[model samples]
Structure formats: structure tokens, C-alpha cells
Target: MAKAIRQIKQVDPAPEEWQAASLSAVVKAAAENGESLIKLLEIIKQLDGMGVLNAMEGLLQNRVDVAEIALGQLNQPTMYHVVKNGMNVFKFLGAIDPEQLQTILSGITSGFEKAAQSGGQESLWKLGKSMRSPEVKRSLAMMTGILAGMGEAMEQNHSLPEGGTDIG
Candidate 1:
């Protein structure tokens, strides 16, 4: 069955109604988050006293041009790469469990500390001896497996993987 169509009409706010609504909103906001709002206003007052607020106001007055200039700057290759890598990092981090990531990161830090304590760099003979340790053997196997998986994923995606680049 087809539903009957009803014509919609727009209603403009009358001055009294708008005033009442605005005042009600202020009251509701104060009631809901009065402490936080007061703290924010106090921070603003401090900024105003320090002349920072007026500087911000002046910048905002020319917001359109400022935004245009910012957009133009962001259009540059370095800025583009910065934004792209930031987004990629966020995406990569999003896929991992926080606890698991912390564990792996701590393990890496521990490995570095242990390596530094032994010597700056091991001799080829020492490296050969170290490689025979079960722990070292296991780590190498795990690292190679992870690299293989990443290489396969890169091949499937057919896109060159990003290397960390800093322009900031």
C-alpha cells in the first residue's frame, strides 16, 4: 500500500520564541555542565586579559583567507605526505590490540637494553654464537615470518608501502 504524501511547511522562529529558547538553552547548559563551562569561560577571561583572545579574534575575522592559505600550504607534497602517513599510522594502530601492542613494544625496549648492556656491536664470531641461543633463534624466526606476511600483503595490495618521513 502507498502511503499518503503530506506537504511539509517551514516555520521561522519568532523573536520572543527565539529569545525564550536561547535563554532556556543557557539555563539547561548551566544546569548540565556548569562547572566545565565556568572553567572554560575563566580560561577565556585569562586569555582576554593576556591579549591572546583579541589576537585569536583578529585571526578569526580573516578566517576565510587564513583557511585558504592553510589549504594551499597543505596542498604541498611534504604536507600531503605528513597527513597521509599520520592517517596511515592511525589506521595501523587501530587494527592492533592496545595491550598486545604494549607487550610487543616493551619486549623491543628490553631487547635493545640487553643488547646495549652486552656491547655496542657484537663481533661476527659472537653473533654466530648468539644466534645459536634458543631465544635468538626464536626471535629471528618470528621476525622473518612477520616480514614474509607483510611482503605478501604488499604484493597483494600492489601499492608501495610507506616509509616514515618527517617534514614537521
Candidate 2:
């Protein structure tokens, strides 16, 4: 029994070692450039824009399901934390009002219904493929530029003096 226990102990990692290994694995996984990562980011951005968190009480609950799907493709903990943090930021910024939240929920429900009626994942993938058009690209670029300008303005406002005196 002692010999068996020793063998088990030899195979099991120490807590600190395990943590380090996990962090290393996450870094390695995140280093990879893959379509799945792009898809994940796109999904997160869409969810943020659509105010998915405001529609759901426990926004992080679906994170486990997302992590499970991403297990082989991504570092589970990193993916989970990224999604959770993104959702938290969205919530913190007050991105969703009641009307917008309801619209997002309705859109999701309608999308699911349409997917069920047509096909399933294949149909959804086709829809996603269709959305990658030039018009969509232009719109995305414009929105990104607008948001970046807003962020820059906010930062400048916060950094400037109250009397707006020129430091130079």
C-alpha cells in the first residue's frame, strides 16, 4: 500500500507546479493564431454589442459550456476568464438599456428559431459566412474607428487639467 501511494504521489503534481504548468499552457495556447480564436473574438464582440449580459442575470453561467467546446482548441481557464472579463466590462460600462436588452434577447431567440427551422450549426455557419461581406467589413471598420476616437477623447479628458491650461 505504501509503494502504491508513493507511485501515485510521484505522478501527481505539486500545487504550485500545477499552477505554473497551467499558466504556461495558457500562454502557449494563446500564442497560437487560429480561426477558432478569431471566431471566439467575433462572437464575444457580437455578444457585447447585442447586450447579452443585460438580458441574462448570470452572464458567466454559459462560460463553462463555451470552455467545454474550446477545451481542445484553447486553454480552458484562459478562455473562460477572457469571456467572463469581457462580459463584466460590458456590464460595467452600462452598454445595455432595457429596450436594447429586450431587442438583443429577441434577436437571439429569433436567430435560434430560424436556425432550427432551416438547419442547425451548418446553417448558422453559412449565415456567419454571409456576414463576412465587404459592406460588413466597411461598417465594422467605421464602428471601430468611432469607438477608438471616443476612447481617446475620454482618456484626454481625464488627463487634462480642470482649467485646461497648457502644460507646455
After best superposition, candidate 1 residue 59: deviation in angstroms?
Answer: 0.8
Cα deviation of 158 in candidate 1 (Å)?
A: 4.5
Which 10 consecutive residues of model 2 have the lowest summed lDDT?
1-10
Model 2, runs deviating above 4 Å: 1-11, 33-35, 58-168
Q: Give, for candidate 1, the lowest lDDT window spanning 10 residues.
A: 159-168
The candidate that achieves the highest TM-score relative to the unseen native structure: 1
What's each prediction's TM-score? 0.59, 0.26
Each model's lDDT: 0.88, 0.72
Give each prediction's root-mean-square deviation over alpha carbons: 9.7, 25.1
Error of 2 at 133 (Å): 50
